[model samples]
Target: MRIDKLHTIDSTNSYLKRISKEEDAQEDIVVWALEQTAGRGQMGTTWSAESGKNLTFSVFRKVKRITISEQFYALMAASLAVKDVLSKLLIKNVRVKWPNDILTDNDKICGILIESVIKRGKLDAMILGVGLNVNQTEWKDTPRATSIKSRTGIHFELEEILSMLLKQFHHYVDLLLKGQFETIKNDYEQHLFKKDKPATFIASDGTQFVGIIKGVSETGKLILLQEDEVVNEYDLKEIQLLY
Candidate 1:
């Protein structure tokens, strides 16, 4: 439960990989940065953080008896951790967008990137990188983007928020190991984007269809109800949710 705070790193996620070969880095060690120059997101996208205005940290945890199929459980835990911290901070309109984006009033406030490092035949460690827009007042002309300070007009201490997030993350991770996926799933569903409403979906072939948001499967596949008769399951990027 001890976090090794690394101040002013280029990127916490990158630093974890740089130090992964060292013998001294232990489990539960967290690498944090006040300013990240080369932060990364899922699929090689650059994660933007305005220096002191956001939360950028990576957590390294050891895992066992879990396959890739269970990776969504870890993501769900992290999403819930953000939700829990924000709720306590009195940020009321927050929700988790499926897979891994945290939103408030339908605007993105956080992004999570989880990477697993497997050595030989067993799981070595998993790196969870979280980027939370905390105190930024303006969002660089990006649509559907927001920050906690912009929404509430109150500034937050990054250190305190980081502490709360780590605690909640560990708690939910324990629930994940206990096979309590339903808890995470239900809570996540409650915050789903356009839940139970007709929405537009753009498939990979550029075909558009109108589907009602149903729910996600246990393995994290998105389920959609099309034409009130056809139900389809989609993996990420296979079907894009049109806002």
Candidate 2:
């Protein structure tokens, strides 16, 4: 694993993509940035993190023999990797929110964004970007954001955590490559946030409803048991889970 340390960058994911195109990039190359000026999250939201305070990095991994339908396994691998790292640090209440936001208790501590490159209906490679709130202690405008130090009141070395993450990430990705779909899915659901709990959800059309989160479908859809004894699976664009 080669880590390219950067003082500042617009986005680590973008940089990795560029380097993978320009340079002869190899697999497992990590690009770590001290600051991200234009970081992004799911749903076109901005990922705001203080410079030199958080783990904002991306990893480029070359995939083989994986299809687009199997892409959700990559997400499961990444989420489980982060959860494993947090649990090893003794961070209690670590749960993986649907689609890939990591929450401890009620506040978000990490976010993952994975980009895949497909060719001829087959998966080529993926850029896995992670934004983890590590030592940052204060939350100014973001009320739901929290960090490891904020949760545990103890500072952590960013590189150490990154190393741990990479190890766990490789472990899960290897499992994915070996076609262990059921194992990964079951492990991910075990750490799923609010699983089997009744919660409110707002659809994309601004309609709110209550449903119990059963788990996720094989293709990464949120499987919700509705009030009228109907179970429906929704994509990311179809619904937003409300705490």
* lDDT, candidate 1, 1-243, per-residue tens: 556665577778888877866754556778888888888887688888788888899988876656666777787788889988888888878877777888887788899998887778666678899999999877675688888788789999999889899889879888877888889888888877787989888999999989887888877878888874888888887887777
Tens digits of per-residue lDDT for model 2 on 1-243?
788999999999999999987875666789999999999898788898999999999999888667888889899989999998998998999999999899999999999999987657788889999999999988788988899998888899999999999999989888987899899999989889999988999999999999988889889999999977999999999999887
Worst 10 residues of 1 by lDDT: 20-29
Positional deviation of 214 in candidate 1, in angstroms? 1.6
Report the lDDT of model 1 for residue 57: 92
Best by lDDT: 2
lDDT, residue 35, model 2? 98
Show how many residue pairs clash in every candidate, following the order shown.
Answer: 0, 0
TM-scores of the candidates are 0.92, 0.97
**Candidate 1 error regions (>4 Å):** none
Best by TM-score: 2
Angstrom error of the Cα, residue 183, model 1: value is 1.9
Model 1 per-residue lDDT at 147: 82
